[model samples]
Target chain A: MNPAVPTWAGVAASAALVLLAVAVAWHGRLRLARDIAIAATRAGVQLAAVGAVLLLVFQHTGLVGASGWLALMVLVAGQVAARRARGLPRALPIATAAIAAGAAATLGALLALGVIAAQARVVIPVGGMVVSGAMQATALVLIRLRDEARTARPAIEARLSLGLPATDAFAPYLRTTLRTALIPAVDSTKTVGLISLPGAMTGLILAGVDPFTAIRYQIVVMYMLLAAAALASLTAGRLAEHALFDDAHRLRPLTTEPRRERV
Target chain B: MAPDELFALDQVTVRRGRAVLLDEVTCRLSAGVCTALMGPSGAGKSTLLRLLNRLEEPTAGQVRLHGRPLADGDVLALRRRVGLVGQQPVLLTDHVPDELRVGRPDLAEGQARTLLEQVGLPAAMLTRQTAGLSGGEAQRLCLARALAVGPEVLLLDEPTSALDAASAKAVEQTVRRLVAAGLTVILASHNIAQARRIADEVLVLRAGRPVAHGAAADIDYLKEES
Candidate 1:
């Protein structure tokens, strides 16, 4: 083990730290505080459930089981993303494309480059991380794009009247808005070493990995995140633009549908 | 449903959390004519205009365009056919003329210049930042944007209420020209004199209800009541 974490107690302490987070979440009285508490409790249950499933999958090594596990991850991620985007375009397809693309590319690269064998242990965590990152990027991009689309409605209508196609009409605003969404990933990648060390690289170093190997892994992960975020943002942005326009190239009215009143 | 009747609100009523914003309001707006919706600040004139374009759906009534229900029709097509210009003149672009032609980024810059010119703005404003535009320039730009869509019906909510006399006159002249070009105009304004100068028909609204509706030239009684 590396000098930073030479014993198993460090991992144990990390696990215990989650309890403090739960306590803090519960003690707070804000609107989202209860939600945070619920989310933390749910996360604990989910992690345990996932661990039980993974324990069986690792031992069996069957294709059906492995694919099923991945599918569950994708489905859960997509559903969460869609719920976050309450009214914007269909979030499932965007999340699916983003997660599939990001996971496949990153996992494939890691295996081909011989970073680790195509074993269950290495593949599952790394794939999950890539998918999760892509999901976050997709959500941010979709929300930002939707808001920008509304803000740019007048400009869009102006172009439509000027005889432009729906796609062509939203291109200018869409371009800038999508670019803005990708900035976080870009800045994180650019300033990785000079500003702050990334979590994965630091964890690996603490776990006794060689400095050079850790750095290479970090570099690859950073590039993968960039690729994933850019692809996801672009896909989600285009999807949003299409969803908001009609066949005759007119902008659709935004909905303000009231929540169903319970008797 | 006449070709001339570009927009018509038929027994439209709007409620906000159980409070009536507009109640059973009926009005017909025609082509090649300016109709001023004269009312106090809180009257439903702006809300009524929003209903005409399906910007806000009515709680219990329907708006019609060409004799068909506004809700039943495609919203995008309707909005494209009817353009809106508000008091604030929200120009959703930093690149001025370029942003104005967003969907058709390939559209010639000169076309945008022509639109600015038509709205009483100098062609030089084509390159200026939209944020830098004066209130009058911004208002004209909004009109230019509305006109850019080739809308048969135009909804103007206090188009000149925020401008100086010179700018107001310029905007009023543009409205007259638009009417002359066969575009339908529905304007909501507090300026009675400006209304008389520009409107062919006038509808007086009080407390979200229409009290009087008729030709603008027959407004002597309305003036007496004021």
Candidate 2:
């Protein structure tokens, strides 16, 4: 059975499976069947668009074009992360810089070490995985940091009024946010092959790669994700902490309203 | 400005959007005296107190500490000299001693014990978990934590409003003792009797404006105004 090319029949079968899940959701009165259907449809359309673009880049693009594609992905991911962190100041720039730095550093190290060749087919997909992981970490850190600043206002203010510096006052919250952001990456790495086959390994095996080679690549991907997530979350957390306080080291009133004006 | 004035609010006004939290308020707080701020809930008593320590900035006018603007020097140093005890006691750490040692990490155990005793808490309770303390005990612990920094002026916003009669009395006596020891204190309270008992002067607020300012015994206008 050739797994390289997927037919429309296979896609239809997948849609039927989704319908079965949606039916069960409706039966349970979860009220999420519609949401599931919408999300699944959106995912299909988005993935198909991305697949078309990647095929063009892989077939004809040089390094510059491949890099441009990667930058576009990072930009889109940053916008999504910033939207999730709507009330925070300078969320877009902060998320973009963090994600780009994390993905670039990890991918650069892999290439420099000669572990992966700098080909469009290899670099583009690996870069996408790294950027996506970092984007998720950045978004989680920003959201959690904003929440901690809001919910722990009294405690943070108490410390500040006691003459503690802003950094010292927000230390506990920063620690908690970073830990929470990094947990998913760490847990997925731990359970990668034992509980569930990860996407990279599964895709490579289905593409007729040797099992050993696929496993090795998956391990490298996992390690890169953990490093990238840590870097992105720490950077985003540090930048977001400044937005929580004013120049006087006082807790700035949490901006509850949506910030429509970009700085 | 008076010679002994420790804090002066000059034509201060604080507005949040269209809502005026504090109107034009000008007053002097003398050193080594407890000035009780008495007003209704929305009269901006807490907002007024916050301005003294720059917890909330004024939209107009200025706050002066010792003939200098409150925003002049290092804010952290200013906040250290002007300690604040919020209405609800919030401890950062589990142990009572650790709570007291938040900013003052070099605080000696004996000094911590003394602060606990000063606030009418048993010295032995310093080692106990803060979460295990009752409401009144926690309030007193917060007071001790404030005193741990050795602040010259203390701003308390309804510190005893949440405590029972006995605990309130204990806190009131502690404030009185501190005032006697030359600690300047500004306290906000809804309890007029409490104000009369511990305050040397009374400043009555009405809808973000100061309606009366005089000796504690002479502010009988509050009884009619409130």
Candidate 3:
């Protein structure tokens, strides 16, 4: 049986469901109705733009153009992640290096092993997935590491007073932050088939691929995400740990103002 | 400044933006002496203690150890020799023994027990969880952990401020014993009685400047503050 291609009518129907949800939220006095509406519209526009761009690159680009596109994705991801980790010195460079290294290493290995075809069609999508996963993990690790270091100042200073190096003093907090950062990816992998079908597998199956083939692709994607997230979190944590302290090994006082308390 | 001074601050000043936390204060701490920094709240007593280990840097002038500038040496090595116990106890691990051994993992269990005994805690408390410890017990545990580094100088910042009267006495006695063991101590205390009881000399601070520095009995400024 041939897979049915989604037409403009199908897209409109999906959007109508979002409008209905927004109406329900508005009736319940949920202030999030506006946010829901705006987010749905934004997601639709962004996805359409991405789809067009990917088609152009897949049809016309060689390896050089594909790599350039992948680099652009990584750059944008790094900027977003760095903004989330605002107030950290050198956060942008740190996030960029970590995400790039993680995505490059994982994609390089997959390509070298001949597990995935070395074409723009496979590399761009797979590389985009790896980069986004690392971006998320890096952002969480940076933010958590900074927050933990600030709140745990007394403990860190106590350790430093006993002659422990900054790296050794921050070991426990780093471990906690890395674990927190990677748990999301780990959990999704664990619950993939049981809780819900992931996007890759569902997409492949809907595109007329056999179920077993989709499952195999989904498994590889899950493992690759875990590897990328782990590497990203660890690298980001290590770099952020140094930023928390000064050359004298003293905790640098956080310059950012405390977040306003929610009423 | 005496040639035998262990620590000497010459016109040391610390500024946080526009406000000066510590003004141009000069003092000398002689070797093997217990010098108490007596001040009211926010008078820079804790800031002065922090300077000894380079936890906080002075904005102006200099702090010298053994007649050499503190900035001249490796800070980690300097902190190892000059240990600090903060106003509140902070432990990294759940168990008392692990907290004690955190700084010195090579420390033997028996040696840790001996340190606990010196701090007036029972050796059996070593196995107890740090979360279950009383405030005083936690403070003493911090002290024991500081001692694990074998520091030549110890800085205590309101070490007994959170303790009950009896707990305060235990900590005070432990500190006295450490001083007698030839460990130089710089203690920051708001309690005049505690300072009088333990200090050989007193440096009185008011609004970040030293108003008096002399023998504890001779310094009448503390009496006025009281």
DockQ class, candidate 1: incorrect
Model 1 over residues A36-148: C-alpha lDDT tens digits?
Answer: 55776687688778888888888887545766677777777776665555566565776666666666666677779887567776667666777777777777776666665
TM-score of each: 0.72, 0.93, 0.94
Tens digits of lDDT, candidate 3, A154-215: 99999999999899988989988899999999999989999999888998988888999999
Question: Judged by lDDT, which candidate is best?
Answer: 3
How do the residues B1-226 of candidate 3 rate in per-residue lDDT, one tens digit apiece? 5766898999999998888999998988878989999988989999999999999999998999999999999999999999999988787899988888888999999999999998889999977999998888899899999999899999999999888998899899999998898998899999999998899989889889998998898999667756
Interface RMSD of 2: 0.8
TM-score of chain B of each: 0.92, 0.96, 0.96
Q: Model 3 reaches what TM-score against the true structure?
A: 0.94
Model-by-model lDDT, in order? Answer: 0.75, 0.89, 0.90
Model 3 scores a C-alpha lDDT of 0.90
Top candidate when judged by DockQ against the true structure: 3
Ranking by TM-score: 3, 2, 1
Task: Give residue A21's error in model 2 in angstroms.
Answer: 3.8
Cα misplacement distance, residue B216 of candidate 1 (Å): 1.2
Cα displacement (angstroms), candidate 3, residue B177, comes to 1.9
TM-score for the A-chain in each candidate structure: 0.78, 0.88, 0.92
Candidate 2's residue-wise lDDT over B1-226, tens digit each? 6888898899999998789999999998889899999988999999998888788999999999999999888889988999999888788998988999997999999999899888888988976998898878888888889889989999999999888898889889999999998899999998888887899999989999999998887888545645
Candidate 2 or 1, higher lDDT: 2
